[model samples]
Target chain A: MKSKITRIIILLSYSFVNLYLIVTKKILKYVHPKIIPIIVISIIIMSIASMILILNIKIENHNKSKKNMYIIFIIPIAMILFIPFKQSECLNTNFTVTQNISIDNKEFESAGKQSISNNDVMNSKEIDINEVIENNKLDEKIKELILENDVIVVTDNNFVKWMDELYENKIYENKEIQITGFAYKESNFSKSEFVIARYIMVCCAAHMAVGGLMCNYMADDIQQDSWYNISGTIKYETYDGETLPIIKVNKAVETETPSVEYVYPY
Target chain B: MYKNKAKNTTLHNLTLIIITLSFGYLLGHLIVYIGFDQVSRTVKIFSTKFTSIIIEALPFLLIGSFISSLLHVFVPIDTLVKIFPENKFTGTLFAVVAGVFVPLCDCAIIPIAMRLIKKEVPVHIAITFMLAAPIVNPISIMSTLFAFSGKTNIAIIRVLFGIIISISVGFLFSLLVKNKEIINDKNYCSHCTINLNNTVWDKINELFLHTSEEFFNIGKYVITGIFISTIFQMMFDSIGLNNISISNNHALLLMLLFAFCISACSNSDAFIARGLMNSFPFGSIIGFLVFGPMLDLKNILVLNKYFKRHVLIIFTITLVLLTYTIVSIAFF
Candidate 1:
């Protein structure tokens, strides 16, 4: 009977977490907004399953291994309670505000240099943004900004497409661009260098990877995980023979957390 | 008894255990070398990743459990045994086709297959269904189509490669495993599978009870798989694994490595694979798409929960080699 109660409690706890996440909209932090419908259906099924489990409380069936199942499930539930409710807060409060030595270790970067050079053959070839944009239906506004705008301001929706266009086409070289994101510095980077990273959440946080342009701002006081807006011109940096964009910033200001935490492209 | 009961003390089992243990330790050291801890960014990332996977996978997992439980209570064993294909080739073909129609994700399919096997379905048919359903499903195909921006070739090629690989793997297994039960279903819990309720209410009760059992059992493995794979992905990312260069054949190998480690769901993996466009060539991208749903880190852990470790290891090796060969040939 005691074991039966524990099982019921565990099942209800599962439903409660789902409800809590949905009620608070914290589910958006972990997964895309599109998945909310699936989540709704899951909670309904679990809730029904729990009620059925309660009515059959006298079944007396679970063995020692059966009880152990509930024990293992407690790990995920407990860990979820500690997660920040908002996606933006997740970066601002929990993640790296400063460069962790492992990520930017000089030896590691140099070791990877050989492979980076291999891509120089591919990256060296010039890509025409105008032609590519006309052929491709994606990235309407941001893709057009390259030839028209004097200073392109990067927003959450166009962040990824803008990055791709800027990387390939030389039109953006030495052009002023304004961007805002969580500040992250690699250890191999000097004090003046850091990446303003934004997570590209395709479906959920599970598929997220750090993406941003490297910025060269001569300042000692940059918070690692906090959001910052930087005004800079796109410049090229060569590593082992392959060249990629690096921002040379004229104005670096610690900004309020961005309204949008992640860029949803797909 | 299950597959392992016959081969308890074999050198093969010992070697597999040692390999698994070392792989785990290697993962641990990688995190520690980077100074990971409770307060570290990696830990937070781990929590987020684990939670997201579970949350995303929950609906499919429950629906799978419900289907499995429904079969357990309502569908008689004799009926189940009757519907199974008589011939090996036809059975494998039928199972792959069933996967395309039913179209459950991997999370949902395992429990359903286990239920079928419990009802005396052929091991190969069930395993084939498990492998093929997630990959060839309409949702997965449509997602692939959308992710690749309606490149019919990418979606078509992926489904073609997936069907070929799983069918071959299934046909091979049917030759080896025959109709022997891979899972030990006897002398266990009195609550589910073995019981056949008469009254409608009693059957419904059995359904819910069995659903609970299947969910909890599968959830444990899912959690463990998520924990290991997420930590592995996070640790590698921290060390800048993706930033490294890939040259020629190495791209295919590395993409396979990424697919194994990353373990994204089949439904959404195309988007992730699409992101790999510039870094690796089309052949390697194809390898990642085909190889992932069949034999990834998460699926391996789930497969280990049922089959013998040696069986999984062998099948994994076979799947890897076949995918590499077929994809290389196709792209060549």
Candidate 2:
């Protein structure tokens, strides 16, 4: 008689959990995009199985071991019930590029021209001469020397989007943008076009999504997956029903690869 | 002799019932105190923490579980025994390879491997299969590929490392724990015996029973692991660990601690690893995947139930060392 009551309680508990999961999944759909389908399916399957198990208990002959099975089932549900004890708000900080620049508006306009006007300023600091030439401000021969020595090239879809956004916002329009990412080129495509790519992960690398920015350059000049820091102007184009953005290369240079190549800014 | 045996059996049965009743009461009390509102909140938190893990791992778990059930229901024990070399050295090799093909996850594999061990499958082979099957199966392989975005090299490295570790550990275990007396002597067909006279129905019953049992066993582990991990996640959120500089490789350290505490199943660890990647490293993430399936809090409890203390100690040490080595080499 004691065992019969225990069995009924176990069955009811299991049924409640199964019903709870189904309802919870429905509630979660508004909060998280990916989990709704998985939750609904899991609840349905678990509920059906629990119902079958409960019905089986009713017909099966009295067995002492059935109690043990109920114990196993309850432990997990009990553990799950402990989740609210630790629930708290997640901290979210938005680090924007506009926040990084400390320079006043007066200093910004003069800094670029002053650096360009003085020969001492030009010679003392590392400046890409090719950029001056590309902007039609310097000689082509000086630009060639600059292109031959120092410039980093990035070619990946995500990097391209990042660069496009950075350019559209005028964050690095007249200034230098230093980027480190992988180099990729599609075969049978244009020889002058390549991409710098990096994988963006949300939680673990398992859900890592690839992002890169496109760069127009000779394929022979850049190796795949090579790290680079290119200083260039960002440009935009439209292709295949999407607006495309890219960096117009003034100079390209190779650099030592970082030990950890992937970086998720978010 | 029959009377004495019956008396001992009755005593054991009574003890088991008492344990179950006490555990059930504790569980009922926990549910009631937490109340329906809190219960729903906990479930929501747990489901969120584990949703990604389950999504990433479910396909592999299903495939691996199905394959394992198929092997159990269809393959003859003698046929499996014949495939391996009789010598321990070569037998361990066959064991590791067999582990890769078997679909059983960490917890469910224990019973199936024990069954194989009783049927004259070499102890080393069974041990290797038991250790490696959860980490090296086709479903795990597919999930890893999809998780890493077809990074074939990393997937290959994981499989190779798993094989090497499982084989070596299996061989070591066979030498250390040679006593047959330590193994469970219960009938493999205890649950299936009721419908045995009808072969077709019996086979169907066995398959259904085995699958259901396997699902419940592993599912419980997953649910528990997810709950603990969620708590940890909440703690991390409260402390503002998410905003910390993960780029410095400290994310791996945090995830290792999290994996140890949560003790998630290997098949589902990838999803947890995925969510963690935003804060951890590829190497430390792999460590969680390799180690959690082999040695976790829940599996440890299950292990303690069957294996002697001394054997469990050796197994735990070897598994931890191998996991550390494999993950270090891959990430460092």
Candidate 3:
């Protein structure tokens, strides 16, 4: 059986952890900013509640089984402090990105159809890519970069949308591009092929999904989890019967992993 | 006798602290020796998801516990009974309306509902409040509106479906289960006597005492639910359901399953649903938005802990059928 003090300490410890997360600004990595104020209020209420519990500790409620359950609360604290904080790229092994690029004419359909189709559901509008780009009113620098055609850079902000555009329009036929990401190799892929991937985190590391373009390079020694800066040109490839955007590398150099590992969804 | 009890409690507490410290040391050594590389990535994903779920829900859990404390200590149970109308239909309707006003998250709703049920509120009404409050609230509405900005119909459909389904389920539960107490033996303490004439300080102390006790008791369930949900998410992610090609109906099933496992907050689920707008059908996306806030991995555990096994099962099955039917019919 545990005493009231033990219960109080457990509650206080949780409050302490929240305070720690709030102070360290690590809470943002796990939750949206909208919940931060709530977290702060929780800390205040929890700490006050803990103090009150301490002041009025009793000896009557000593159920051994219930006391044992309090141990579970310690897991979160242990996870945050003891576990080595690393990128969630561990999900690369099984994580799958949507690779099918079905340019449809029904872009203005009232509702999204299923990714697969048996009949005319798959048909979509063939909108002009250049006109769409012009209408988007992208930043002048990004516009210049995309038109550079020789060494276009794909940052986190424009990676997914840009890729989607290039895939839809098939404009990156032979345009050179430079991108930086960690290497991920699928089980079926050869040693010469890897995915240069980044996690686009919408909510937290747990909710992060993989976002990257496939790469075809000639480095058998490229290790998994190693970050690289690869200058490559676009190459269309059919892997496992699905056509996808593959970067044919011109130059590859090892680079330090970015401090902010995960990119937010644009 | 009192002195002996106090001494024994202190000794037991000390022993607990020692044991906890020892476990911590062993765990620390294990993590260091194995390192993250040796440890399976699946485990890290599980831990990361579990941690995020708990951290994300912690604030709401605290708020719910606090609200439960205030209700138990300050508010009288009979007052709740008085406010609820006599007709079961109106009562359920009242619950749905009231649910919209209180913008509690799923994590916050259970504790408050437990308190309500303890106060002799109708089981159906409490269930209505529990299921509806999370989705029908203002914050969720705003987020849904923002997420489906151009397509205002989706947001409206989400809110309307949330209310209709919740109220109908409340009626169904009302039919199956009577207005009896649904809280389990562990938490129901209505028989305990209270001294209303106690001083303000004593009342404050009593309030905090009950608050802390309830928090500790329920917090365990929250953590357990999160752990299980995280493992479920890891498995789901590993399966890579998104990669598969399926018909719209099958896609809805997969999405419903996904929503149950993911257990994202109602306020943020809109964003996730929006993200899926490109790949999944609109009906399935609606299913994701509607079904998740109402029933998910964590809240299932909470509901299981409080309600009878039969009642919980009935609620789950009923909610799933109703949500899927309404969404599919409306969209398809």
Candidate 4:
């Protein structure tokens, strides 16, 4: 009788974790939409099984020692209940602040140089702006950005790719780009320079990486880790003896943070 | 005498209720304090990463357990034995292809594989299924392809490499393992697989019973694995592994270790691999793609419940050497 109760409690807890993920809407933060069906199906199957097992609790008692292992399963329950969708205070706190500010200029230069040399053969010729336009399967927002006469909105989805292309091909050097993101500055950055960035998420929040573009604007108004909208023309600037594209900001406005903190990859 | 016995039982129940309520009250207070007030940075970071991993992985683990239960209840031993080829080469080869057919996650494949082994399926073939299914599954391959931005070559290479390592390891284990009993407990099979030839309702009940059994049995190790790997990832990230300049071989070694330590699900591991693409060499990334799903901090603990010490050692060594050799030859 004791074992039966333990088994029911354990099985329900397993079911509850999946059900909790669905209820709290925290499931979206973890997996892609394509995998949702499988997740739902699994939850239903497990829940049904748990209910069936409870009805017919004729399980032969196994090793008594194994009962101790069941205690560990409660960790997920505790985590889900206590910390569901809560932001970590340490995320943008002092330690991260210090780490973000203490950047190595030489390392950036080397990284920039390494990328140029490594992909020189692959992208030797200039990239055709028409080629990107010709790709019909591209996101409509990106297509709209391309179709705009001179100004382009660098959204969270297209920010990383746009920056990579602008860095490599240098075709959009003179076009005015409008981008909005939080301000991030490295130690090596000058007072007038910072990055407009968002965390790029390819799979889940756990695998997110920082993706942003360099901006040269007045730093007095923009605070670290605060959101802002900046309109700027693209230009190659020599910083710390390395030449890379930077947005020469024409206007800056403080803005509220976006609902979605992380940017999904396009 | 009867009145005294009833009074004793009533006292026991009351004590249990009182203790539970007090514990709940304390726990609620503690959580409220932590949520509102400040805590150490390490504690916050650990909680965030730990929750993220468990949340992301629970679905896969559920799917795995569900499949394992289905296999335990429905899949007959004769059906498997008959389908298994007589030739050892074909048998191992079939194991590799069989993974593609089942298309389950790493966490789910172990219970099914263990069941097969208990059913007297060739131990090495079952091992092959265990290693290859996580990597070679259609869902994983599709996700890998998508993650690499439609790079079919990388996806194909990962699948091919997974097959090669899985086959070699399977064959090696077949030669090395003398005993057929892989599980530690001998009586585990008797209760789990019994009542198979019963009425339909009884069979259905047994299915759920066995699934619940299999899930709870393997679920603890997974939680332990996740806790350890989360700490490992946090330390590696905070320490800034990318800051160090590493040689190609050195990077490969580091990446392989990272793959083992992080133990990200195979479906999403490609995204993690792609994230590391610009910083690390292609070979090291490929090494990570191949090595991670086959073995990681969590699955290793899960595997320990089944395989012997020497078998695991052989499995690990053979996979590492073969994967390194193949990746080195291809890229370097």
Candidate 5:
């Protein structure tokens, strides 16, 4: 009689889980916000069911193994209880303040540079190194100002517009600046112009977008894939309906390529 | 005899339950106190973003379990013995291919695979199916489409590559581990050995009881996975790791680590991938989504239970390589 009752309980619970699975998927699509509570309830029910099932099964001659599995099962539940709830706190905090600050100004900026050792500024900051170099000449005063302020808000959608505005305003003309990034020689190999590029990642490196700045250098001196710190003044050019910022080379020197090259811009 | 059998089965089950609950509680406490808030937060974010993953996946789990139970209940061992090809090589090939069509996730597939083992299926075939079905199923493909937002080519590439790797690795391992002595024989508990002589109501009651026991056993892990993932997500957002600038390649590394920490299901990993698109390189992002569901922190615990340690290790290494190669080629 006990066995029969156990069997019936199992089957009904199994059926309910299956039904919930099917219904929830559809419900989540039409009304996405309700997914959280539904998921929480589903998880709770599933956990209870799992505990009961684990209790009923017996592995002959494997007491230790069964014990270990039990440990694995309970650990996450305990974590759930002890871990302080922080989701609400996180939602309340403004992520934008950090985003607006340039990578060079983040609280962990110095520590990050120290840990990595290679001072690839392009990979470290929110401002495009190329864009910054082109739009604002790195006069000692300007460089010092940037170092002090230490935040650049660069987004893929706003990059071109920002660059155009910087050029029109002559924000970086004849001011010596330093920019570091990967060197991508334009395929056309124009004698006096080439593109320097860096990857911009938004979430994790999986969905990376590329950002680049045009710089004019003597054909013989440019090397593809070379990492460089170019000190230059900003110049503007128009090509095929797009405005391009040209880093008028004051000085160009190659630097060691950092061991890690692609940087995501959050 | 019946009374003795019932007593032994009951004792075994009760012991198993006690062990599982104790372990679950211990691990949960350790994670919370250990100060790996980064991991905790990633898990939480993943759970919140992909709540539908468990829901979408539960149906497949139930179906797989039902089929396994049915096979256990009705199929005779002698009849099952003749179902495979006479030639080992041909049998393995058939098994690997068939495994691709089944589409069971790692957690649920174990029960089905164990059933097959009992039904006299070659261990090689069972292993192959266990690995292949989770990533190569119709739902996985459809979910990938939703994650990538109509990148049919990426989805196709992932599925094709997934199958090739699983089959090849499964076959190689079959050759390396030829000892069939480890396989368990099919022996139902006295409770499971229902007498047809009983009334219809009795049979129904028996089935329900058996199903609930199995459901509860597995359901705990699912819930744990969801809760851990939810907490991790919250922490990740709070810390603002998403905004850090590291090179595209390094960003991929972080993403892979993050995915492992969160342990999202394969079906929902793509949605997480989509959310992260702006933060990392395309290749690295692909690696995070692909490699994670196959061999992350949580899935590894589940896989460790069924597969030999060496087999699991080899599987993890191969999956990482395959995911990296595919992503590199696609993005480059």
Candidate 6:
């Protein structure tokens, strides 16, 4: 009982919403960069599909009860295209740095055995981060940069790997460190101290976890959602029975938030 | 008279669309601007996270629909049957292996698997494809590899357990539903049944037609699914699951249920599991990785569209129990 053109309009909307996201680059906020290639492929496919649909039209019959199905697409498509919402950086709930990891050698060895046993069927060795970053993720540029400058300056590119270097701060104990992250304060923390952190997006914003070094600063001007540049010396101390690095800030200054807030591993 | 009638309906539809869109737009602005201090933040998170899932899976759904449409138009049903072994055991086994190669996520696999069922392919074979396709694909395995970088055992165990659970569940269906009615109505369309007289161009036209049709058809279910799962995501956020502590077995059970509720795509579910792995035991994170793809809030609703009510009930129970028993025995 419906015109075939009605269905064509719905189908073309499919192509439009996808195309709108890709062209606007609004999709970057939701998905990881690696997903873009497949999205482009899909856009191309949808274009051809809608083009063909426009060319070939017919008066198709349908039950009147089926009309409500068309309404389901409206709200989501509109929300996607028009809504002024961003995934908040306040997603510190799913993330907790302290963990009970099984570091004992017994469980580690058995885990290795079981991996090999199951992977015999696969016969493929997936290149993990360790393999790609052979030298503990310290590439020549970073190493040279560290050697040249007394202070180790971390950019967005090296933020994740360099922060990871905090776990073993043997080499960089006395090295002056400069980094930038948003201010995160816990109610239990001392008034002069807070965690300077940025969200480390694993696959997308949905899976982002906060990663940053703790800063012991005596500043009262720190604001939420504002970026801060902290220059300090790497100070290692035992906290909660574990040796951890805390930045002893000599200077802390508020700065404008960067264009891209979330950092991805890829 | 006919032309005028058609014209009026078209105008009516356009007016209807404008009203709905304007209403939706105003509603969105209201949610963002007009709200309680905490209410706005929850809504903000819900919208962004909900879209991330839909946008992330959109490409796969598009490609899956295209490939499935190609099969519907170009490939004959006989070819689909002949490609698989006629024997039940071999057919089910082959389907599970074939599932690993197809590389569609749980959401994308539904249309293909249901189409196979409609084409009179064995229910067990199609069911196997639906259950196992997402868990062992190349992209998923690579993601798992990266997520559990130092501990590759979790990645391998996920794939291993996925295949085992898939085969067992497929066999379970074969035994339980053999010689029983799965689909009550068999009056689905097959205009191309007389494609013998159609040209290649005609077949290609049919291909695009099916593609467009399938996109919208599957989309309704997908959007509905996204809505339900987002609601659940917001609920969990409010309840605050992080502070609670339970026994080892209870944690595993909770994780399985969480996987079903969140309805994350299989490829990205590994990353979510990684975040939780720091808190939960290694086995429960693996349970989240394994149980999620086989069944979820979204796919279960979509599955209801093609399957009978009782069939879905048993299917869900079988998958959950099989996944729980296998994962606990293997990892715990």
Q: How accurate is candidate 5 locally (lDDT)?
A: 0.49
- Write candidate 5's Cα lDDT for A101-205 as tens digits: 112222211111111111221233224544554434424223423421332332333332333234334455544445666565534557676555544322221
How well is each residue in B6-28 modelled by candidate 6, as lDDT tens digits?
74467447545645654465366
Stretches of candidate 4 exceeding 4 Å from the true structure: A58-60, A63-65, A88-90, A93-146, A156-169, A236-245, B1-39, B84-93, B101-103, B150-153, B178-181, B185-190
Backbone clashes in model 4, listed as residue pairs: A101-A187, B64-B108
Residues B21-109 of candidate 4: C-alpha lDDT, one tens digit per residue: 53454455457558544444445555566666666676667677667667667777677787899799899889888899877668778
| lDDT by residue for model 2 (B200-305), tens | 7556545544554545434444444444444454444335333455542455555556666665555445544443443345566666666666666546645554
Model 2, residue A169: C-alpha shift (Å): 20
As for DockQ, the candidate ahead, 3 or 4, is: 4
Please give, for residues B1-332, the per-residue lDDT of candidate 1 as tens digits.
45434443343355345446645755675566576543444456556777888788766788888888888888888797677678877887888888988756777787788777777887778878888888899878877765554245667779888988888777677666645546544322345535554788878777787787777767766766666666666655565443567675787888788788767788777766664554457778888898887777767766666665556666777778877888877664
Model 1 TM-score is 0.74
- TM-score: the better of candidates 2 and 5: 2
Which regions of candidate 5 deviate over 4 angstroms? A1-266, B1-63, B78-106, B179-209, B239-255, B308-318, B321-332
TM-score of chain A of each: 0.71, 0.37, 0.66, 0.75, 0.40, 0.73
Candidate 3 Cα errors over 4 Å, as ranges = A62-65, A88-198, A210-258, A263-266, B1-38, B81-94, B142-150, B189-193, B245-254, B268-281
Q: In candidate 4 chain A, where is summed lDDT lowest over 10 consecutive residues?
A: A94-103
Model 5 lDDT tens row, B246-271: 88667766877787766655655655
- Residue-by-residue lDDT tens digits, candidate 6, A73-120: 666666676655554433433321111111221111112112222222
| Alpha-carbon TM-score of each model against the true structure | 0.74, 0.51, 0.71, 0.81, 0.49, 0.80
Candidate 1 wrong stretches, greater than 4 Å: A62-66, A82-153, A165-178, A187-194, A214-223, A230-253, B1-43, B71-104, B117-125, B138-157, B187-200, B238-264, B267-285, B308-317, B328-332
What are the runs in model 2 whose C-alpha is more than 4 Å off? A1-63, A66-266, B1-44, B50-77, B85-90, B99-111, B146-152, B179-198, B206-225, B236-256, B264-286, B305-309, B325-332
- Native contact fraction of candidate 6? 0.35
RMSD of each: 6.5, 15.8, 8.3, 8.2, 16.0, 8.1
Model 3: C-alpha RMSD to truth? 8.3
Highest-lDDT candidate: 1
Write candidate 3's Cα lDDT for B256-298 as tens digits: 9888877777876776665466567767877888899999877
